[model samples]
Target: MDDVARLLKESWTLVEEHRDRLSGHFYARLFLLDPALRQLFPAEMTGQGDRILDAIVTAIQVVDDPESFEEYLRALGRDHRKYHVDAEHYATMGVALLDALRCTAGDGWNLTYDQAWRDAYGAISEKMLAGAAADGNPPFWHAEVLTHERYGQDTAVLTVRALQHPLPWRAGQYVSVEVPRHLPRVWRTYSVANAPNDDNVLEFHVRTPPGAGWVSGALVRRTKAGDLLRVAAPMGSMTVDRASERDILCVAGGVGLAPVKAMVEELTTWNRSRWVHVFYGARRAGDLYGLAGLRELMETHPWLSVTPACSEEPDFDGEHGDVSEVVARYGPWTNHDCYVSGSARMVRSTLRALAEDGVPPPHTRYDTFGDL
Candidate 1:
C-alpha cells in the first residue's frame, strides 16, 4: 500500500479501538456545541450516536483507496444532504471525530495522526460539497399528508405536500424519514414515486415490509391526513436520463414499482419518443398495484408498453414467470438502458442476468432499498 493508504489503515485501527468512547464523545460534543442539531437527531441519542460512529468507522476503513472510498463517502454526503447538512456541520463532525480519536489514542495520537485524518476528511468533505453544489442544496423536508388511499390490506399510497421548495430531483430518488418526537425515532428511507414537475407535490407508495418496525407499522396503520412527518430531502443515484434517446426498460419487483412509476411518468411528460417498456413482477394478482393506471398510461402513449409478470400465476395468460424470464421472451434488450429496483438480492440477481444477456454495465442501473 502507498503511504496515504497505510496511514489511513492505521488511523482506522485506532478508531475501532475507541469506537464506544468516540461515539459517545462525538455526539455529546456535537449536541452540546450545537443545540440546534439536537432537533435534527432522534431523541434517543444513544442508538443514533452508535449508528453515526459505525458509519464513520466504516468510512475510514475503506479510505485507503480513494476511488473505492468515494462511493461510500458520496452516499454519506447524499444522506447528509437530505438533512441539509452544510460545510459547518461537516467541520464540526470532523472536529468531534478527531477529538474522540485523540482521547482514545492517548500517547499514540500525535499531530501526524491528527493531520492524516484531517486531510482525509477534508478531501472527502470537498467532494461532498462539490456534489451538493451541483445538485443544489436540497431542503430538509416536512411532509403534509394531502391524500392517502389504501391500495390493499397493509399497503397505501400517500400524496405528500412538501413544505419547503424541493430540490431538483429525477424519478427514483429516495428520502429518509424520521419521527423526531417519538422515542427511538426509527429512520427509514422510501422512494419518491412522483414525477419531477411543477406539481410541487411529492408522492410515496409505501407498503408494510414483512416484519415491519414500529415507525413503518405506525405510518401504515395510524398516520393520517394533516399529520406532519419529518423527511430528509431527496437522495439517490438511480435515475432515468432524460437526455438519452435510447429505449428505456424498467423492471420492478414488488414495491419496486414506485421509482419506476415515477420515471415512466417523467418520460411521458417529456414526450420521450424512445420506446419505454415496463416489466412489473409480482407474486400474485393482489400484489399488483397501479396496474390499471399503468395500462391506461401505456394505451395513451404509443411509445410505452406495459408487461406484468406474476410468478405465482397458475391460470394466467400473458407473462407468468420471473421478470428475467419475461425479458428474455421479449428478445434482444441490447440497446436499452435498464433500470431495476427491488430488494438487494433481487437487484443483484437481475443485474447479473442482464449482464449475462449482453447488457453493458453502463446501460444498467439499480437501487437497493437497504437501511438509510
Candidate 2:
C-alpha cells in the first residue's frame, strides 16, 4: 500500500501542473468511449474539471490510511449519485483517467505507476459501489428556502426545509447544494449551520465575493424565500466527540462560523461541565454577522464563550490582528479538543499556531474553504 501510494503521488506531479489539459483529454476520451455519459454532466463545465482533480488529489493523500481512504471514497460515491453514476460509469471513468494521466505524463509515466493506479482505482470503485448500493436515501433532496437575510454586499444567512424526505446530517458536516433555477447542475458545498432536528430544517451562511462562485453568488444575491434547491449527501469529520471530556477550542473566520456554531449548538443540549471557547473573526466588524447569535447563545449557556475580532477594523471594540493570532494569545490549547474552520489561510495559520503550542495532530480537526 505504501509503495502504491508513493508511486501514485510521484506520478501525479508529472501531470498536476497540466491539470487543464489532462482534464480536457480525460473528458474527451470519456465522451469518445461512450457518448451517452456526456449527458450526465453540466453543459458549462466551468469548474467541473477542478472538482474531479480535487477528489483525486484528496484520495491520493489518504490512500495509505485504510480507514480514511475507504470512508472518503464511500462518501464521494454517495455524493456522485446525484449525477446518476453507476458501476459501469466508474469503470469507464477509470479508463479515461488512466489514459489522460498516461498521455499527460508522456515519457515520465511508467508501468509501475500504471499498475499502482489500476489497483488503487479498483479499490476506490469497489468501495464507492458498495456505498451507493448500501444507501437507501435519495440521490438528492428538494429543499424550499424558508428565509434569506442579507449581510452586507457579499454575504447571506438562509434557512431551508427539505421537502418529502429527511436530510440527516451531523453538526459539522457540509452538503452540496445546487440552485436549479439559477445554475442548474452546478453544486457548491456549504456547512450546515444548525444541528439535526425534527423540523428537517438546515441553515447556510454564504459569502460570495464579486464575480466568484456561481452557486454561491446565486445563493447570496439572487435567491429568495420560496426558491427550491437540490441538497446532496453530507460529508465531513469535524463533529464533536461526546465521550471526550476535554475542553473545546473552536476558531472560526468569515462565514466559516457555520459549523462551529452548529457544534456549539449541539453541545448546548447536554453540556454542563465542558468549556467551549469560540474565537470568531472577520476582516471588518460589519462582516462578523454571526457574532450576535453566538453572543446570544453565550447568555444562556454559561459554559460557552465567544470572542469576536476584526482584523481590518482597529476602531472596533474587540481583539485586533488575525483570528489565528488572537487564538494564539489565548493558548496553550494543547489540552482541548480543537476545531478550526475558515478560509484556507486562516485555517493554516491557526493549525500552525496549535502545533507550536504542542497540540497533538490527532487532537485537532479542521475544515478549510476557498480553493483549499
Top-scoring candidate (lDDT): 2
lDDT of 1: 0.75
Q: What is the lDDT of residue 147 in candidate 1?
A: 86
Work out the TM-score per prediction: 0.75, 0.98
Give a tens-digit lDDT track for model 2, residues 1-372: 999999999999999899999999999999999999988888799779999999999999999999999999889988989999888899999999999999999999999999999999999999999988888999999999999999988899999999999999999999999999988888889999998999999999998985668899899989999999999999999999988999999999998999999999899888999999999999899999998899999999999989998999979899999999999999999899999999999999999999999999989999988842
Give the Cα RMSD of candidate 1: 5.0
Alpha-carbon deviation at 11 in model 2, angstroms: 1.2
Clashes of each: 0, 0
Q: Model 2, residue 42: displacement in angstroms?
A: 1.2
Residue-wise lDDT of candidate 1 within 40-63, one digit each (tens)? 665555456666765666666667
- What is the C-alpha local distance difference test score of each model? 0.75, 0.93
Q: Which pairs of residues collide in candidate 1?
A: none
